[model samples]
Target: MSIEIEMETTTMKIYDTEGFPNPARVRIALAEKGATNDVDFVAVDVMGGEHRTDAFKAKNPDAVVPCLELADGSHISQCTAITEYIDGHFEGPSLTGETPKERAQVSMMNLRAENGLLNAVGAYFHHATPGLGPDLETYQCAEWGNKQREVAGQTMSYLNEVLADNAYLAGNKFSMADITAFAGLAFADFAKVEIPQSLSNLNAWRAKVAARPSIAG
Candidate 1:
């Protein structure tokens, strides 16, 4: 069955810039929800400063990608918020979980994947390397950025331990946490932050997640 949400799916539009980690998270979630074909997907040229333009800023004050526009023209930014909305509003394979305890655990694991892996890799790239633009890159600190790379490595070890006994990041079920972790690892690869070969569990988890059609999107 197709995913069902409170809002009209035909009127939903997703503003996204492909290949980016955050936007990929939303795309994967949408795919998993079986809502990809229902929504209008607008691809913004993020590198071309399309996201920084005044018109885009009006849609999302943060001026980032993966902004979800509802039928009323209202927008929702941030991967976690957008994914949470999709998971709750839509009816399909439950990415967040059905039970209260399951939801809490999945949310917690998702946060860990987002902050510990994705954000850390992002910080390292945006700060240590040539960032988006001069206007945004002025505040970057190479030293701090390098430190975040180390932090990302440490987090990988911790996550490996978490996955050692469990099939997925949140537990047995393949949830949003797994998606975030997959996105994070992909981002890390883009940023040249290689996942240590020593992390066997995480490596295995990566292969499993990558095989999913949602992740391939």
Candidate 2:
């Protein structure tokens, strides 16, 4: 006999952007956990200052990308929070982890990648490039931006070294940590930051992750 599993459908409103990293991370996570169709996509134009508007700030005071507005009028900011919620509530594969030890490892790796690698890249972009052409003067700290780029490059090298033997950043399975790293790395490319060819393991792993339908979606 075959057993069928039923999953409750949940509708979510996602405030996102097409080429942004933070939003893409949440989008990719939703795809990995098969929660894409459950969400209503709302594109917030970051370049147009939509996120900085009062209306957007009411939903998220931080005015950050990838805000999740629930049907209950509750809002959740931060890509990690949204992904974690989906991983916990969704009925498919758990991206966070199954066991206590596994969860800890996954969280640890994910945090490291976000803080050390992703944040560095963000700093590089905000301070160096500042795609906000007219608002470029808002970030003229070229010295700081250059420093951040170097830091991010170093962090990528470190991550590549650590991921040499591991199939994924957290451990053997493809968890949220890998997703975070991939989003960060992808964003870095747009920022004109190049990942060293020496990071062959990371490149290989990225290729594997990129092949996922969710990523393509």
Candidate 3:
């Protein structure tokens, strides 16, 4: 479906790190939208605490990657919000659904991917493990992190079941939900949480999504 949306007047700068799932999600959305050339990509040294510094904090209070800096000096943080703006501003494939119902369904599935899988993996990674460093991971909770690993695994199975009928996470077409789910799976891999090989449907779906040029590094 063709969407008629206004272009963003502001110059776009993407602050991100290489190989990070959240940053990769934004890159995938940009690739899908064919808007990669439209913005200046800046690599932030996440491991060097570049994102945690006061200078970076002024740009993004959350101190997280994949933050979009607009020409008006406003910042858009979080993967979903950035993708939504990019989808509406650029002329290309729509990552979020086009219509109201489509948008609602896509947003629903995207949240499911976030809370059920992505956040679970993130909790496990930060709480259960050493994370970035001692200075950063001051409140590590091994027990809570370990529990989230199991939660992530369970969510993966649930996702597998959902994908059994649908071609993508939200519906037949590729959307933000799929990008979020893919990022979640990548996070799981980093967290050492394995998806069961017995879930053939999910395995096939993973392979299919992996083949997409948008996800290709």
Task: Compute the lDDT of residue 199 as modeled in candidate 1.
Answer: 97
For each candidate, the alpha-carbon lDDT, in order, equals 0.90, 0.86, 0.90
- Native-referenced Cα lDDT, model 2: 0.86
Which sequence of candidate numbers ranks them by lDDT, best first?
3, 1, 2
What is the clash count for each candidate, in the order shown?
0, 0, 0
Best of the candidates, TM-score: 3
Per-residue lDDT of 74-160 in model 1, one digit per residue for the tens? Answer: 999999889999988888988998899999999999998888889999999999998677766768899989998998898899999
TM-score (all chains, Cα) for each model: 0.92, 0.91, 0.92
Worst 10 residues of 2 by lDDT: 130-139
Please give, for residues 88-193, the per-residue lDDT of candidate 3 as tens digits: 9999878899889999989999998898899989999999988877877879889998998888888889889989999998888999999999999989888888
**Which residue ranges in model 3 land beyond 4 Å of their true spot?**
1-10
Clashes of 2: 0
CA-only RMSD, every prediction: 5.2, 5.8, 6.3
Clashing pairs in 3: none
lDDT of 3 at 59: 91
